[model samples]
Target chain A: MHKHLLLGVEAIGQGAIDGGMSGVYAYPGTPSTEITEYIQENELAIERQLHSKWSANEKTAYETALGMSYAGKRTMACMKHVGLNVAADAFINSAITGVNGGFVLTVADDPSMHSSQNEQDSRYYGQFAMIPVLEPSNQQEAYDMAREGFALSEETGVPVMLRITTRLAHSRAGVEYKPVLDENQLSMPQDPRQFVLLPAIARRRYKSLLDKQASFVKLSEASKYNQYTDAADKSMGIVCCGISYNYLMENYPDEACPYPVLKISQYPLPEKQLKKMEAECDSILVLEEGYPLVEEQLKGYFAGGTPIKGRLDGTLPRDGELNPDLVAKALGKETYVGIQVPSVVANRPPALCQGCGHQDAYEAMNEVLADYGKGRVFSDIGCYTLGALPPYETINSCVDMGASITMAKGAADAGLIPAVAVIGDSTFAHSGITGLLDAVNEKSNITVVISDNESVSMTGGQDSSAYGKIESICEGLGVDPAHIHVIVPLKKNHAELVKLFREELEYEGVSVIIPRRECIQRASRRKRNISRHANH
Target chain B: MKSNIILAGVGGQGILSIAAALGTAALENNLYLKQAETHGMSQRGGAVVSHMRISDKPIASDLIQMGTADLILSVEPMESLRYLPFLSAKGYLVTNTTPFVNIPNYPEYEKVMEEIHKLPRFIAIDADRIAKEAGNARASNMVMLGAASPFIDIDFAKLEDGIREVFARKGEQIVEINLKAIRAGRQFSEENK
Candidate 1:
């Protein structure tokens, strides 16, 4: 038996390859970023020439995967929960169009907003799209489900949704490997018009999809991932889903848990096993990582006969990720309370790295804008977003990836002169270009600053899609060549940068400022790699 | 035997490396291991931690419960105290004496050390100095791991082997420097004891 210590993301990548996946498409986002990165760096994936490059965004990534699936080859698209929202159009439509080959959409949800804007669950998306959802409780199970999910999808002619949360995506454990499978032979759908979702054909496809729901429920009921294990105690039955099952197990060590358990790793509620557990026990306790989907469903419209204890009933906290201590308390076990940290240990929130280009850009912007006052600078997500914190406190808003440019445009149009937008290079490519075009067309008086770090530095220095193309993209967007300014964000250039910002702030037309500099972290990583190569 | 450890430090300080070394050693001993790490936003020079558990039996949660961690191994002095809540009542707290002062209001270095010293069980070492003496200043994380190695249940030889395995791809010279750093750290702890 071959075993290796792998992260959950790495295991998923290996599982996809072992399951004969032809390509894995994704846009870089935390927890989910490593899935494609692992595949990109894998020797087997490179040898097989798998399509594992980062797409422009999640929407393009999913559509590309769907197009590959049309050619009868296994494919996977991965993104974070928020990225699913961006890709929801293609994702929901794919279910209506069905699939000729195996397809999987793996979404990593961030519980408690660990590295995300909000803790929105993706299982709801699966239910919304009417697709089979697979949730894994451990690294080994993540691997197995990723491999088996494809076969299940091909068997049912529908895409599968493999959902995981932050903890499972970022954690590491030992996973045993299975024999690798060969890629599927190229083929086409039996029906020529299967993918053409015209109104008339779509209605018929909708009915067929509705017909598959019963079979999907049956599959969930029969799946090995969802099981009912018996115990002596009948006062309460426990229902643990996904990672919650592991936290539940943590509370019961050395011996088996007294309560019967319905471990639901596959979706559709696994009604048969849940019904059996409910009948055998007086009450039921539900343990889930995110929202109380099971508890809310079991409770129905009103409080029912059997007590359903979970986040809904306040048996467990309603929000945030679950831990063993919380699980123990839910199980009515006494837990040890650790000591508090002394006050001398101050809060060390994440700050801009020393010598970051954003720091210099912010310093110049802050100096120029101090006379005009605050709240005019709108920033987007990236390392530059850290300016909202103490010391800088320059940016007023951080909504989404591309909201900075458009929000600034709206504010400038609304008569807020010198409305400045701050964004990073990767984010600009991700979704900011169209907003820039809007600014130029409307002749909004705003100064847009694109901090060009030549990398997606916030997410561990992934390759930036906008590298070496930011200035050209801005120029193509119809900004005048004279108004476009590029400056190296350095201490020596601070006076020049401030002068350019003042000039742009004075201009009534849209102006673009490019603060170009390589991220210090990325530069150091490159240096190390070059030095290592020299040593070799 | 089970060892529940909380490895703490600021991002980019190589706390993950310490966890990797211990994880490799645990695997060599045929022990089951689970490690939950902090990634994404917090990794931008913020305080980060990893919950590492190794057991002869199957591990349960990736997270260590409050007051249940057997050891808190840290590479930064202030970062060492951040996870005090995870440490057991009698848990060992091993930390580097150096401070990674990034914030403006980083409490006095002397005060931080005082709090660490006040702990019931603790060992504070100047890992940076020792690592520099070991021929590679960058191996301070290895030095911190060596200082905490005594409190861990895994065999010392397995940890040395783990160092070899983790640095194997980086070449033999890098491996030798890290091993020396580990030995120097082990010597300090032994002399203090």
Candidate 2:
């Protein structure tokens, strides 16, 4: 079985380099940025140097993969599901401080917001951090749940996640390779304050993570990737979860499904194959890919019993992502529609790239905010959030990931004196320097800009913990090195970037500007990697 | 015996290197593939596609459902009418009559070639003037994967050993200029379809 193909995030970066992951904290984001860029271009993870770099974001890639699972070994953090909401406070307190070596995390959701903003369902943050979550119905169960999600997070010690989506993290298939283990060494954690939580040791490590949630629901009721099967039309049993079980066997291409499927790629909801397919069929449906986290936990909150369908009883899409002709029109079948997008087809969308220094810093910040009125700019997440479309609608807030300097410092503390914030140069080094040090400790009346472009050009060019350190991180966050300027977002540096955005939008207090350059697709991929290393 | 394709263009139109040489000729035809692709923020230049498939067995939804694409291929020209609802009314678009026109109400090219001549299984070549007469005008997506190699079912020497193993690490004159741009896109789709 020497298959290869890969890409469910490079089969969890080759199942964390053949399962004994030595390191890989992440931050590039898209579909969990190619699982740390396929273990930073693996050649046995760069001859075992491992620790794939690029963090400064998802909470410093989940506290540096929980400090390399607290000095024991095995790692893996990954992101994209709003980079697990900036690594949800050390991912829900690293599940009440558990692990010593094996920690996995992973994430990747983006159900319908293709390149994400929300269709979030990191299995309800893996059941609100109660843990054990896996979810991989394809790419060989995303390479055997990332090669046994670190021995299921070290025989149920904690931190496991895995999740996946955005069509099982940007598809492709095959996979194969398995047996390769060996990396644990440095061992420790035998309770010396297991991981000092400090609230009386996090209430005894949160009741041993609630007494290991009944051994993670009896290892998801004997999971061999949670199956069940049994087909003979017991009305509707189905259930799915994770690549929505490959859009339900792509509507059963002779995998012959009358009913009774279960599937649920490992999760605590396996309660004995979800109570034998909710007592053998007669009406269940489910199919989760993003929300309706197991049909809102089997419709718990009254007015429901077995008649449970998915995306909150709308039978199917109460939102997005899910294909096989929307599961063959929600299984009633009858697909085949096709032709008719033609009125000479139109709407293409995603622009900013004809030599894009964010299109000369959004055409000099839309001609210096055409007399600053229509909601002063805001923007954040990379590719300069396509300058909020149109021939530069000049960003009136593209929202999350360093919400453009604390939403332009809460509209410049409500007074809105020329409120700006543009962002990106690795989202102002992810989370934009704590909203520019809370607008330079309240010298507010903002301007900011920082478009930099040095890299992380929207999840591809990568490297940019705000390159060449955004003018000494805006002069060490205090901002007034003569109101920190810098220019070069060229179309011949658009009149010195419109005189540094009209003298940093008529600075009253905190002003930045920046603009800089580099990402013209990361300067032609660093001139095609320095001419393919000067032709070897 | 299945293909499903889609591919399309725009986002740095390399169409994921024609889906990594049709996923390495569907893994040397041991078959069963999937594909999908379209990384981050609509891949900044946007309007991407991918989908792909291949089969002989075991394949389940890496998308490619709505109307069941049997091949769209694209590389531009209204990104092949935006995946005409995933083709298959006995599909086969192919595309690339040049025209990426990076947005700006870009519609009429004789009304997008009169809506790809109302597709009765289209072709529409140009492919950057046959990959600049096959000398490698960036191997025009391997000349639109060689004008979509006689509508894919694999083996045109396993797509030149899948572009000689995905351009054998950018050497050998870039795999002989992407196998002479997929043989000038399979001799202009065998003398124009």
Candidate 3:
């Protein structure tokens, strides 16, 4: 039986289980994190002994899922769009290798950069890999596609990409689930050399992958997800993809749309359906959530192709997520303009919580670094990244996970003395350690501050991979015992912390300062949970 | 009948709880519901809003179009006014009068109230104060939901049942306090209306 209310992430998780997936491997990422979390929390998944746990990183997650598939078990790997970049090498290669059982790589794209560094579409990855991609229009579709995605992969013997944008991933609706399937039994590939990627074998595999493209396209054309809904009005045709289809339908709630609509979810362009819509309608309007992939292809070069309109031709804004108002405006409908907001209502950007350990660390660091001037601190992605915000304004750069240490090392090598790097506990584990190792090897004159909150507080306080192990990890990385300093971040310890920061800044070698404290929010939540449990 | 609502508040102010209660109630009434929420970076104390649509018919879009929302339910006064564009001309603005003063530059509470009062239809109440009087200050979200209950298309009793159902895991005392808070908020809105 299906749940009355199911979140999109939950539906995907449930669908994966029902599709007979034996394992789900992932790293914690916004919009994509909940899929793995759902499976981990599920009772059936636990009983089945599914491999649902956070991997070291996206690359590890991807490779592990491939291993599970090699063992002849249906498997899934999930990550946010940027994480796909880290796993891209393996992901593209896996497409040629082909799967023994079933494999699905789900990447959640954050258009408008919601909790992400960039809004790069994941569909390009699918195209680059020469693999099929499924983009669901709604929560129910998310479930259906996930359940069916494994079979699609098994049939083609190639991994499939299930792409979803932020809005659809976070939205909630009722989803009726399919009956569960038992886990696939362990087995090996028929060909012993299938896993090998030698020059000769890779050439053969690549050619075979190229040969599969025609079949993939045919599959898309026959897919129930790709449909051409004919309309009487042929003046303007609409080609809507994924959640954009819903936005298009929202414009015409009561009556059918006058223009022919080509709704596309499964990709490879579904050329047959597109040609049909083109032949019937005068012009085409492409509605896609992310980068104008379909629009660019349809527009091509040298114009004269049905006057294609979309993010390219100002039919809609080129950037940001789509909404019903934007869709209505594109159709020349009157839009609602609400009352102007008073200037008194200032922009309330996200800030660190009161009594946060990062606040104390920033206060002390700022006091010590005041003489060094600004632009010396390179930060990583985490709650500590908020140090770039007001009051403290301590951090200079926040590129990606683990960029802080490496960026600071580069600056130090380029004669920027006393270069400082700030990273959180979880981020250090995620990707910061290798950079630190490089800095240590070079003996760079830099100060690395690991703001140990003991938990990943930014993403709702998930367990930190480096929990209770920061100091040991730093030591293991070969930092001098005397130079590796740990301090309690608090008001009473402010002066001592400043002194330690000054000492580290003046040191000619890599110095590590670990300001350790539990995240106040997580600490309180822990307290509440413990008390509630005690009462129970 | 369809009810399109924009629930707005500062992150961590319990707007999602309000959305959950309404969604549960709407589901019990066998009404179709679609709720689009904001998660991730903005959740770190940024302004957040959830678009909730309830209808006997299917909801096409997860988002509610501007000027189509029947109600602007907010847990913060300034946050309530932030989504005025989403509110229909005939929509009711039901908001808690409390100012979540997390930022240093938060506007004057009186000025926020003044802006809210300028609306054609609104119910402004001190949900925090009422929730405290109801014996649980943490139930302020329930109080705000209660103040908006009269405008919501669902039955008040169903909403109460939703509170019971959602808070059932937290134990009977927690559920009772929230019920009291909802009743207090509903009574205030009734008298003012």
TM-score between model 3 and native: 0.98
Interface RMSD per candidate: 0.9, 10.4, 1.2
Candidate 1 chain A — worst ten consecutive residues by lDDT sum?
A297-306
lDDT of 2 by residue, A1-536 (tens): 77998888888889887888899888887777877877888898888788898888888888988988988888988888887887798899989997888998888878778776678777787888899888887887788778778877988888899888777778788888878787899878887898889999899899989998998989888888888889888878887877777777888787577787878788888677777777777788887776777777776722355788777767787888777777777888888868868777777778777877778888887887888767777888777777787877888877688888888889879888788888877877888887888889888888888878778877788788767978787788788889887777778778878877888788787888777778788788889899999998
Report the C-alpha lDDT of model 1 over A425-511, residue by residue, as the tens digit: 999998899999998998899999998899988888988887788889988999998999999999999999999999999999989
Root-mean-square deviation of every model: 1.3, 22.2, 1.3
Better candidate number, 2 or 3, judged by lDDT: 3
- Candidate 1, superposed: residue stretches over 4 Å from native: A301-303
Lowest-scoring 10 consecutive residues by lDDT in candidate 1 chain B?
A: B184-193
Scored against the native two-chain complex, candidate 2 gets a DockQ of 0.31
Q: Can you write out model 1's per-residue Cα lDDT over B67-87, one digit (the tens) per residue?
A: 999999999999999999999
Worst 10 residues of 3 chain A by lDDT: A297-306
Q: Residue by residue across A342-412, what tens digits does model 3's lDDT show?
A: 66677888889889999999999999889999889999888888899899999999988899999999999
Task: Judge candidate 1 at residue A434 and give its lDDT.
Answer: 91
